[model samples]
Target: MAPPTSSVELATLGHRIRHQRLSAGMTLDELGARVGVAGSHLSLIENGKREPRLSLLQQIAEATGTDVTDLLSPEPPNRRAALEIELDAAQSSTVFRRLGLAPVRVTKGMTDETLETVLGLNRELQRREREAIATPEEARRANTELRLAMRRRNNYLPDIEALAEKQLRAAGHTTGALTHRTVSIMAEQLGFELIYVNDLPHSARSVTDIENGRIYLPPASIPGGHGLRSMALQAMAHRLLGHQPPTDYAEFLRQRLEINYYAACCLQPEHAAVAFLQQAKKERNLAVEDFRDAFGVTHEAAAMRMTNLLTEHLGIRLHFMRVSGSGAITRVYENDDLPLPADVTGSIEGQVACRRFLGRSAFEEQNRTTEHYQYTDTPAGTFWCSAQTGTTSDGEFSVTVGVPFDDARWFRGRETAKRVTSTCPDESCCRKPDSEALARWHGRAWPSARVHMQMFSPLPSGEFPGVDDSEVYAFLDRHAEQ
Candidate 1:
């Protein structure tokens, strides 16, 4: 009754089976005869084309006179990420799928009763996530999927915008910031009550208590503070839009995207934003600051809106980055033809972004209060970018907006003549120029000790954001026993 192994792990097991059979000077036919399985099926299992059941594995082990543990042992990973990446690539590629293999979902004892137990446990886990009580791993996976989904959609949603705009126009707040009054008015207009609580935890942004027909928002989520207005509206959209609990990751993200779109629509009505963007695009003066000042929203909000406008409205594809103070790219979205650097997990988070990039360079300036601009040349194309640092209750982060050279004609910072060359993903050392260009500067640096500012350290696991993966995996494993 061993726990079911991952596809990659199963592959390793198959390799072990083949190795053991070879050492015994036995062909697949000989092993199949000994294990009471067809040689053709045994060959498939040996070549990692099939995942043998625990009983089959046990019988094979017995036939070979080898311990099951010997076959199940994993190779020493020099780096866990390398293996994860390989697995991800294999799972995505046609090579593995063509062999009649499927990616493993269950990670525990796979019996008939256990299968039902896993299904029940999965449903319960999903229910918890729907209520915003997801485990750390669940949250991270969902967040990753959601980010990828957003990227795939180019961070633009036309249908969602249409819905949001309709709701906004109906509420009588079609353009500009959806003030507290406007949100309240909308709630009243929709015949729903709004409740604000002082003691609500920060993480609990909003709760659409559908049963009570009231949308609850924390005092911190009040509309006036930067993105707070949209945050409040996001919660309201759930109830007003009549969205049910999402049953899967994609659905959850779509619903969330729609909710955020509804929020953004209230702040930047399509008509007004489009007119502004069209004027700026025509004038080639698309400054995010100009948009922020004109719209009275946060720089990040303005930058996010710019992507929507450019990609969906203006037909100018672009890319954006939300980088932490420590240089980790917390978020990235690109609709352009160029590829951005990403880690094996299809993530940019926790990976150091290039220092020459505006997102990272903003940190180098002593006063981060102003927007930093840069023009970068990559193999793909030239890009003009502007980034401004902003603080949150959590910590400070930089938001950047950039467009490809041809697309830059509509952007404000495009004319800034200064240029920086970036070989980024290939040439790792943007800290100085190339890895070879460092010369003696690496060891010759005699700067004063950097004062340790209070920075938000990652969770204790050093991998997940708020929840420990081991803790989550163990929790799920326990539930699997049910």
Candidate 2:
């Protein structure tokens, strides 16, 4: 199998090493002599034909009087250092000559304090320059930009996670389930009020009355000390982040996702989750149920936490899914660079996924279920996935978590070895039936139809049949005032 990495990156490293060697006035033979490697092998390294071991790279760097970091770092060593370098070089330009300024020189022994000072000065000047022509994003544009940003970022936001941790710490959040104390802390700290009612109109999970400084939720929102912590934390995040009323649907969706991520951070702190994953990863014993029990969260919640933390901490790529009882995908998150069979609109929601997949089979289950590990081999690669089928306030749903075969090494039950071939774009995988099987059973089986065929529409959409946006909006407006 190909390495679970990029050839381009490997090629880039080789080129960087070659460039450094030439700059040091060393031929392949000379560098190989210092590194104690063959000239032919060194040539391969210089030509991007082979990867060098760490010890060899160290020797080569030492031979060239350069640090190993100078050769291996894909980006600048540090942001402040890069800025200082730029700032120092700018003083040598013709523009600086016109200003009668002398060029600055950077030394190897430059202290972080000096670099920070340069960065501070640089940012201040840039801020001042922008102040004269400052333009803030309007709500609609802000939302659109935010959505694109999330897509580009694949929703793995470390900065937001860090801020959420700070907020959680300030709110006195501990390592367990969230409680009334969380709500009380937000109300006291943010000067907000929480009110519960029998039903939240418009089927909204929670609504905020910004003018009244009140947040409203349904009584059933939190079933236990465990539930609705995400909701409460999300509501708190909006206020904490100073997010204003959404100007457009994009903004609204972005704000919702942001707060939800903040809520997850509060529930499953990053450091703790990373530590847990590292341990599980080393043992190859990770399971959503185990995470849920360990973190005191639901199956779905645990699945989401794993997806968010794995990439950042363990370098494990994964895919997540939320499917309804009717084989419709409600939500998806993927960073594995694999193609998911989405609808014609380039969306998975409200679209029929592979019927043969475990998530789709979940609809027929009456009780909560977890599928045995299954593998999907497509043109892209072989992927292994497991799913937990569950129910929510609305109806039955399933959460499937997937990782490429290479990543399976870090998770539990990777040895299940249940392999399945999935060629997603083609219908033959699930849609086509064998002629002999049809001949054997088509007329032989006599199952009574419970519902009249005429009563069922040929095309059914979304989770619920009759729900409309305008109806939801009307209900929300009425509930907002209350």
Candidate 3:
């Protein structure tokens, strides 16, 4: 008798699991360990010679950095149906992509029924998009009309204020203390107040008080000022009539202030850092000092480029390191491929230390005493490089690259401290053999050894900083030479 035929569904699941694992640069043994299975068993499953149990399927999905549902339903999905589901998902959350589930499922079914279902879903999606698109324009027009009506309402401020004061007095406040300036000061202190103090250029001098149960602006006698006062008064009235003031005004004020500060930070240099990052993407290698000189900003600004690239654009988490002797470097930035533990030390001797790989020929030829190094370790293996920056540092700032090392690298070449050579001695060991202290000391000799990195995905258009991109590519390409 022939062997049992393998289920196509099981085959599909195995294929997807293998794909995700490979994409993540996980070895078969590593993946098997994560999934609680032997590598040989996983190989058989991937080859469709053995069916994975349900629990094993879950483990495979988790180990491969994918959703269990995605692994279970790995049949080729109908493209059109998948798109429709994706659009629906996007409507509810801006970060729908993080859901980690393929939106559509492919299976043997009724041909006409699937088509009709997809068609209906597509039509509904289009309707929703149309409504969403139209609502913003409609809101703009409504806002304009509302403003016009507000101007006409400004004539009633005195009456409104009188009524408001009466109510406040009823609620146990001295009416005499309710002057506009007093209220403005109180509102400023309270912080939750959203009262608009309109000082329009052409408008008359008036104070709009949208506080303490009143919607009023001091009325202006002149025509131009009257219209302006009316608008301001109208805005106050709308707020008073529509909603209650925040319960904790102080807290509200604090929150608003924080938000304002964040906005200011985002808008500073008018998005110059984001632009530079985008430009840097086009290039293979980037020089920090050159970028700062061109943009007229600080090292922090240039560093933000890399931060945004990794965290925002590529969805990668970054680890920051400030080596005691080495200035600062981005130690690690990785997606699912090479997830480093959060508590991993960002130092070479402590975890993974960076070693400058300056060529012997160049060092001998130039008699260069100091060198800068930058390197990253992924599951694929270690990558290293060096670069020159214009910024110079004293003993305060040293050039250094960040490296992620397991315990082995952290402890390697560390315990051997015998004075084998006579040329360099204790306290003046300029030519010490490869050791952790030697690496740290060499990094400190430079002004600033910190190398920055930005990790972002290629855009759909495939456009990036071509010159810098080429240089970076060349550096990576010449990794064997280094």
Candidate No. with top lDDT: 1
- In order of lDDT, best first, we have 1, 2, 3
What TM-score do all the candidates reach, one by one?
A: 0.62, 0.59, 0.24
- Please report the candidate that would top TM-score against the real structure: 1
Q: After superposition, how far is residue 199 of candidate 1 from its true place, in Å?
A: 1.4
Better of 1 and 3 by lDDT: 1
lDDT score, candidate 3, position 440: 73
The residue-by-residue lDDT of candidate 2 on 15-82, one tens digit each, is 66776787799888888888899989987875446877888888988988887777776543345435
Using alpha carbons, what is the TM-score of model 1?
Answer: 0.62
Model 1 misplacement above 4 A? 1-145, 220-224, 247-251, 431-482
Model 3 spans with C-alpha error above 4 angstroms:
1-271, 283-286, 314-321, 326-352, 356-379, 382-394, 398-482
How many Å off is the CA of 18 in candidate 3? 45
Question: What are the clashing pairs of model 1?
Answer: none
Query: Root-mean-square deviation of each candidate, in angstroms?
Result: 13.3, 14.8, 27.1
lDDT of 3: 0.38
1-482 per-residue lDDT for model 3 (tens digits): 12224455545555666677887899789989887889999988865558777788777777667877776664534453343334343433422333465545434363646755755665565545333322323322333333234224321123333443433344343422123343333334333232332322222222223234323233334432313322332333333334333222222233332322222222222234445544554453334444445543344343333333334442333232223223223222222222222212221222222222211112222323433443434334443323233233433222222222331122112222211221211223333456777677875776765453321232111121112444434433443242
Please rank every candidate by TM-score, starting with the best. 1, 2, 3
